[model samples]
Target: MSKKKKPSVLIYTDGACSGNPGPGGWAALLSWNGKEKEISGGEPDTTNNRMEMRAIIEALKALTRPCRVEIRSDSALIINAFKQNWVGSWIKRGWKKSNKKPVENQDLWKEMLKAMKPHDVTWTKVKGHADDERNNHVDGLAVEASKQYQ
Candidate 1:
């Protein structure tokens, strides 16, 4: 008997920041046919949430065509914010937060939403620094991106 394999997907993600508003980075993986690839990037000064959002956005941007993707992040803010449909509501309301203030990362959120429009996306939360393989890969990539970032 032979085991079946899951379909290809852009996968698990994570991002990190040295400080609330400091060096930050994001990471992701592309998996298919028993192969996997990792990618990441960062900015010198940014927020943790921004990196989290950037991780997913950059992963989607890497795809040449719309495809199914499963994104796992350690960011409850990102996960809950997205899963609860808050982002859509925010977009509809001109990117305002519940306090009627402008969203912190409206630019990235808008870009992320647009990038995801053509794909089937599923988001999950994983405890950071846990043993999750893909999650760890992305975390590593994010950290590396931050360190190597210009």
Candidate 2:
């Protein structure tokens, strides 16, 4: 007998802020087997990058078991960080960047890393505020969340 395989999940995430370091929000949309779920939250005072990482972290935490996941985002900082091994390098160098500066969001980055440890995850870059319907939806969710904190 063979075990059944779980369907892969598709997730879209986005983050928004009233100012670079002002009230912010994060949103994630998870879909599997034609079922979709959306989650979002806001921070009274947070940076856009923190919200972005928070969105991904929260989405991965929603998974019940180890499985393949494809996450789409409009933040190149995230997609490029993983694709270019920026996170690995930072961990290897005391959470400092190439210039020896402390990583801006070490705490959030660490949380995201731990949340992603059990799954095979892929990151795809999507154009922000553009034609992609899913992206647009998630972006709208994030914007709404941001408004909640205002």
Candidate 3:
């Protein structure tokens, strides 16, 4: 007999910032086995990219077990990093880009890497504020959360 595989979870994440370096927010929607959970939070001062990265980090952290995960995000930096092997390359180069510059979000990337270590995750890129309903919903949640910190 073979063990049944658990259902894969789907997560949609988004981030917003009141200003480039001002109050920011991140939101994530996790769906599994016909159930869904939404989470959002804000920071007093941050950047949109950080919030974007945080959304994925938090969603991965929320998982209670080692399961398959599919992450959809609007940030090119996040999606491309995984899809294009940017993270692996960065790690090989000691967290420095090809230009010999330090990676901008090394801390968050490290956290995300740790969170991802035990799970199987596939990343998908979605256009922000576009036709995707789930992405749009999370975008709204992030914007609202950002206002609380502004």
Q: How would you encode candidate 1's per-residue C-alpha lDDT over 12-34 as one tens digit per residue?
A: 88888887889998888878668
CA lDDT for candidate 3: 0.95
Q: Positional deviation of 62 in candidate 2, in angstroms?
A: 0.9
lDDT by candidate, in order shown: 0.83, 0.94, 0.95
For lDDT, the strongest prediction is 3
Cα deviation of 16, candidate 1, in Å: 1.3
What's model 2's lDDT at 58? 98
CA displacement after TM-score superposition, residue 39 of candidate 1 (Å): 0.7
* 1-150 per-residue lDDT for model 3 (tens digits): 999685699999999999889999999999998999999998999999999999999999999988899999999998999999999999999999999999998999999999999889999999988899999999999999999998
Model 1 residue 46 CA deviation (Å) reads 1.2
Instruction: Quote model 3's TM-score.
Output: 0.97
lDDT tens per residue, model 2, 1-150: 999675699999999999999999999999998999999998999989999999999999999998799999999999999999999999999999999999999899999999999899999999999999999999899999999998
- Candidates 2 and 3 compared by lDDT, better number: 3
